[model samples]
Target: MANVIEEAKSGRASCRTCKKTIAKGELRLGVEQMTQFSDTPSMQWHHLLCAAGKLPGELKGALAGYEGDVPNRADIDKAMTDSIKSGKAKPGAFPYIDKAPTGRAKCMQCDETIEKDSWRVAVERELEVNGFMRKSPGYMHPKCVAPNLENVGGTMEDLVSQVKTNSLIDEADMDAVVEEMTGEGGGDGGE
Candidate 1:
């Protein structure tokens, strides 16, 4: 028997939804597969929320056009099991694992303050290959985490834009300023 969980645990695949590299020894949201009666075979791994986002469109007209509420872990697990048994989904087909919270000062995406006691949803900016990927953890304050994330939209270009817009001084201007300071007797006590 093929064990998808074991495969994912060994780092052979990744999440299709988030496009992030899933590694071994990580806790995945779970695997899922769906296929229409006549449609070609398709399967994917999702990052819980990412899977939820796709459900409405993926279910098509079968679903009554209503966005459902948040589902518990058990609900997703059952769905995964059902899909696997039906051969529509295979285990370890889609690899995904929600990264664990790391104690960091501010949200990397928005620079918001974080509380020390609990874990808040945060977007990790500098994700590494493994061994303690650096994260920008923060309080997120419930309301702010989602919208702020939506607005910022975690991209290298967005961060670069933020850095360019929030500059202290231009490089040329800084050079001139430094020259002026250095020319002033070097601030030495010789005189």
Candidate 2:
């Protein structure tokens, strides 16, 4: 449960929460946590804003101890505030974009490509074994959400609103992401 801000030694490491490269020599937030794969805790790297979006409740303590430069402190604060106010209790479970940080994921629904910078829905399936809980992540293209989540009480707009409050995506980007997601826009992805 230790955190630090450090320079990325190389481009090989990407943000665990964003899947985007933190340019070499750029300072990044590293949050340590226990994982099933290792006896020792591993450091999880995240862009400042990404950390704010994904783990707002923990950001304060992490930031309090960090001494390195945070180039976008204001933006990070705003994102963290928004996420904290989202009041969903468990932000991680909310379907979000980029969202799971899987570099190249195939949709579980349509088997189509989820390219970088495009909208992809993240859903988690929880398993309880004996006494502990574990989660497995699944991905879907925006168009695939309806079929994949056919019976979910909320609508596409609800998902978008959740993502907006919990992720670093801006309103303008969300509009386009929503458009591409709902098939309201051309299929070219506006590229």
Q: Estimate each model's TM-score.
A: 0.21, 0.45
Q: Which has the greatest lDDT? A: 2
lDDT of 1: 0.37
Report the error of model 2 at residue 95, Å: 28
lDDT of 2 at 166: 44
In model 2, how large is the Cα lDDT of residue 146? 71
Clashing pairs in 1: 4-91, 4-92, 114-139
Q: What is the per-residue lDDT of model 1 for residues 55-95, given as tens digits with 9 covering 90 to 100?
A: 32232111212245333546654554344344333112111
Q: With candidate 1 superimposed using the best TM-score fit, by how many Å does residue 65's alpha carbon deviate from the native?
A: 23
Q: How well does candidate 2 score on lDDT at residue 104? A: 82
List candidate 1 stretches off by more than 4 Å. Answer: 1-3, 6-104, 126-139, 151-191
Q: What residue runs in model 2 are displaced by over 4 Å at the alpha carbon? A: 89-191
Task: Write the residue-wise lDDT of candidate 2 on 75-151 in tens digits.
Answer: 99888878866754233334565443445889877887677656676766565768778766677877777776653
* Best by the TM-score measure: 2
